[model samples]
Every structure is written in C-alpha cells, then in structure tokens.
Target: MARQDTIDVRELSVHYHGHLALKNINFSVDKGQLIGVIGPNGAGKSTLIKAILGLERSKGEVSLFGSSVKAFRKQISYVPQRNMIDWDFPVRVKDAVLMGRYAHIPWYRLRSSKKDRRKAEEALDKVGMIEFADRQIGELSGGQQQRVFIARALAQDADVFFLDEPFVGIDIKSEEIIVRLLHQLRDSGKTIFVVHHDLSKVEKYFDHLILLNQELIGAGAVKEIYTPEFLKKAYQGSAAVLDDKDGMVVVSQ
Candidate 1:
C-alpha cells in the first residue's frame, strides 16, 4: 500500500507526574481520512491526542502538515470531552461557536466582523442547532451540547479536527447526525480523528483505527486490523483463542 503522510508522530512519549502514559507511539494519518482511536479505559487514548496538540508534557517530535505543531496550530481544531468543561459557565451557543475564530482574529483589539457571525451561524445550522443559536449552553441536553461544540470546531475551518469521546453520552440519532457531518467534512478534504466508544461500529464508521493500550497495539484500515483476534488481545493480554471441530470459536477474556 502507498504510504499516505499527513500527521506524523515519531517516537512520541507522554508523561504526567513521572507516570508514563504513551510510549514510543508512532503513526501517520492521511488527509481527508476519518480515523478512530480505540482502547480500554486508562489506555492513553486522550493522552495521545493531547500530546499531538502540544498540551501535554512529552518527548519526541510531532509534526502536522509537515511542520512543527506550534507552527501548524492554526490548521487544527479540537473538540474536548464535555466533562472537561464547566457546563455552568455563562456563555451563549453562538458565542461559544465564535470562540473558534479567535485564533484567526487580530490581536489586542477584540472584535468580530459580520463574516464571523455568519460563519458561526452557518456552522450551527450545519449541526442542526440553528434554532438554538441564542440558547444558553446550560439549557441544552448532553447531545445538543456536544453538537454545539462540533459547530464550534466547524467554525474553526481547520484542516484537521480532533474530537475526544464525542459519542459517550449522545443518543443514536445524534450519533448518526454527527457521523454524517463528519463524513461531509471528510469528503471536503479534511482529516477528522475521533476518540470513539462503540467497539462494534469501528468497522462501519472509520477508515482508519488506532488501537491503544499505554502503547500502540494496531493502526490501520478497520476491516484489516479490527479482527476478533485483535480485540481479544486488546482486552485480554495473555488470553488464548479457541477453535474446535464444531467450527472456529473465540474465547471471551
């Protein structure tokens, strides 16, 4: 297969208070591809994203768009887990979405032009939350709030989007809507990497998979890498697979 180079992380490692989270992780994502990072709890999935964003204390090199992460920050956008934010904060939906444009705005004198407002509104409409444009963020449901954050990321107009646990508390309908929106974004030649929860849907939803367990386990096309054997190894470190004359069988961890 031809190598598709987009975001390259070479020998990357992350540490927090002397505890190693990610170890010698390396992978390259292709442009316009939807990649899903899967792992059991505490397996360093979120830490990997943080390291790439230059937010975590880390080692080794992380290059985005063939340049240093800091230099390429403007081209990337992130949607953090909802629990990471203070939900009670006083901010309207539109204003929250507008925050994504701050990086592109002129410094010192803070102001939003008509173009900014239009873009924010359009993003909200794209996520089916236009009617809730002026609603206070705390007034929305968990799924609606997630969509608002997605709208904000959309407003960024960044080439690469990183979303963390976007499906945790969302309903099936909301999940489908978000997935469709992500596909639309990917079709427009953008890279979207999401930290997903549903294990069964990985093959159906993502083009690439980044399986983690404090270290890289597998990373490739879902159909090729998301096999039952891989899942067994991921969930049960030393577990054995069973087969019989009755037919091939998989033993649970």
Candidate 2:
C-alpha cells in the first residue's frame, strides 16, 4: 500500500527584491499531521508559509493534496499574525467571522445567507467567542482577538490550517487553550502548519518539526530533530557544536 502526500513542496526558493530569503528548500507533509516550523528571527519560516499560500513570488512547486494553489484555495484556511490585521476596523466579531463565508457566497448578494450566518455563529461558539458576537473587534483582549481569528478560519471548514505566531503575546492559559484546539482540529483529520517561536516548548508540543535558517537545516520528528546539536545550529548558526546540559549540544555565542 502507498500513502499519498498532503503537502508537496520541492525546490522552493524565495527572494525579496533580490535579497535571497530561502534557498532550495524541499519538504513533504502527510495527511492529518501537525507540523511546527521553528527558527530564529529572519530564518525564512514565515517566508515558506507565504510562498505556499501564493502570497509571495517564488521559484518552486507547491501542491496541496495533489492540487494546484487555485484548486486548493477552498480547502486551506490561514490565521495570519495579529500585527498584520487592523484591530480598530469597526467590524463586529460576528461580521468579522462571517467574512470567511464570503468566498462561498455570490458577490451579487449583499447579505449572508441563513446557513452562512448559522455556521458563523457556530464557529464563534467553537472558539468560545459566541457571547462576544455583538462586541466590536477593538474591544477584545489579545487572546480573544486571536480566538476570533481562529473562529473565522474554522468557519471556513478548511482541511488545512496555517497559523503564524499564534502565541506571540499571551498568558499561559490562552496558549494552552489554543494548543488544545489545534490538537482537536488534528484529531478531526485536519493538517495544521504553525510558525512557532518558542524553542523550549517544541518538544513538549509538536509531533513534527521543520528547522530552518535561510535554508533547510533539519526536519523530522521533534524527538529526533530537537537534539542539542540541532538547537545550537538553529539558534547560533555556528559551525562548531558544543555539548550542553541534558545531553544536548549548544554552540556558544
């Protein structure tokens, strides 16, 4: 028996105005897998995500579930970094989440259908934001705002979810809740790819990892790739590998 690939990225490279960001990257993700991409700042983690979403110009091929980006659009949902969206946009929580359904609705129609509205409310409730439906987007806290965005993505009912820095500024409780929701999504046969910043929690959380540094360094199971040696290379980018405590290696700065 042969297993099919969920995400196939080959020879992927990205350049920003002639500045090379990612170089000759390649990776594959299977269905129902939760992948965590980690690297220091400017290590091209987000660049890979953007390229896959067709948000940036790049040289490579990325196919989701054996389909092109155009065909895979409907099955993929994205939760961008909080900084990318405006908080004071005058949009209510309900209306903002309903935006996910606009792709399915006809442009000629001026309002959301009864079914779409129901789905939107259900999505908000899933993220525990149902009561905040009437509140303005700007009135919520950071974790609440993140949850609303996740709810919007959930309303889309996509098979693949991409999250960028979902745990940037939040308390431990909120982070745990978000992680739990992500696990629930995975159990439902969804694939989640998150750009994570916390290196210490990588082993405690993700099942797989993609470690990068302007190029692919190592990617595989977290237990295998989270070794001290890999961490040293990922964090310091030094060729020398020094052994650290806990039998892990660290390259001194």
Candidate 3:
C-alpha cells in the first residue's frame, strides 16, 4: 500500500496580537514517522502545531487525513507544554488520563463508557503508571506527570500526536522511556510531531525534521535538513557551529 500524508500545510501563517509569528509556511508529513519541530526559542514551533491543529487563528490550508482538520478531531491528540498544564488542579492521575477519552463520548452521554475506562486503564499500565493512578497529579515528579499525559493520548488511540517539549524538566530515566514510547508509536504506523529543543538529540531521535524560524527553513529527513547551513539559518542570531567529524550542534548566544 502507498503511504499517506497525514498532514499537509500550504501557505500557512500565524500572527499573535498583530505580530507575525509564522509566515507562509508549507510542508507535508507522512504517517509512521517521528518528526521533530526544531528551532530556537520563540520560533513559532508551538504556533505551527497550533495552527495546523486549528487551535490558533491563522491563515492557511491544513488538512488531516486528506480532509479538513475539523473532521478528524477524535483522531488527534495533543500533549501541550508542561507550563500550560494546571498542576495545582486537584485531579487524580487516572482521572486526568481519562479526560482524553472525552472526545469519544457522544454529546448526550454524561460519562465515559465502559470501554473508555478499560482503555484508559490499559494506557496507564502501558506507561508504567497504573499503580500511581490513584495519586494526585501534582504530587508526581515531572517525568511521572509526562507519562500520565502520554497515557491519556494512548487511551485515545489517536492517529496523529502533537507533543510540545516532552523532554523538558524531566530526569534522564523519564527521557529514555518517552523516547522508546515514541519510537514504538512510529513503528506502529502512527504519525507524531514533537516540538523539541536540544538540537544535540535531533539526529538520534527523529526520523524527519521540520526546521522552522518564523518560516519554513527545511522539512525532510534529518540528514537533508540538519546541515550547518540550515541550522545557521534557523538559529541565525546565535552561533551554531557544527563539528566536522561528528554531528553535534554547539549553540551559544
């Protein structure tokens, strides 16, 4: 079977309070690939995702599953940046994960169905957080909190996943687990876009790269877009020097 493009963006642009954030961006993403949304800070990495997901007001054409994004809401799952989450909210770990299933419920139903509950439980177990399900969300470590949210996405069985900075504020152990889970999702033919920092891990983690800085810098395989020239363009003001022997990006202000 021919592979399908899960996401298609054309002439995409985003502005915040009259400030241009992304300008006339364009790209296509295929399913089953781990694509990194890479750029310097405030580079519209998150905005690009929001624009495509229809979470932000923008001018552009974005299609999911070869159709309007609005038609496929149930198949999409988003794990926003940590700062966006209300950790202070008194929600239990399991309950938080169950929230992802809300979209699947019909408008008439007031509660999740039995199957929804079962899937949520399975997702928690998959992330190794089933035992902690009874605990409060705020009490868990950064990594644990991340895992719980991932479990939320998993329960949804979403086809397209958007994760914003999944690795930030987490210990090494959690990072490793998240990386493995992402790869597993890719292998299972799920498309994922991760807004990532730490250019050092770009080569190791992502199958494809979307290098962005207000506009599209490059979008393709990591080897095609991870060049010094591309990195320099994306990190223009900063000094991004690439070592000749090994592919490591050294960035300094």
Q: Which number leads on lDDT?
A: 3
Predicted candidate 1 versus true structure: per-residue lDDT over 111-204, tens digit per residue: 8988888999999999999999889999999899999999999998899999999998888877888999999999999999899756757767
Q: In candidate 2, residue 186 scores what lDDT? A: 88
Expressed as tens digits, the lDDT of each residue in 1-253 for candidate 2 is 1225668888889999899999998888888878999988889999999999999899998888888888889888999999999999989999999998887889899888999999999999888889999999989888899999999999998999999999988667668878888899988889999998776577767888999998888888888888776777777754345555655443333
| Model 3 deviation from the true structure expressed as Cα RMSD, one decimal place | 2.1
- TM for candidate 3 is 0.95
Per TM-score, the best of the predicted structures is 3
Candidate 2 local accuracy as lDDT? Answer: 0.86
Off by over 4 Å in 1: 1-5, 237-253
- Candidate 1's displacement at residue 115, Å, is 0.4
Candidate 1 vs candidate 2, lDDT winner? 2
Per-residue accuracy of model 3 over 98-145 as CA lDDT, tens digit each: 998988889899878899999999999988899999999999999999
For all candidates, the clash counts are: 0, 1, 0
Q: Each candidate's root-mean-square deviation in Å?
A: 3.4, 2.8, 2.1
Clashing pairs in 3: none
All candidates' lDDT scores? 0.85, 0.86, 0.90
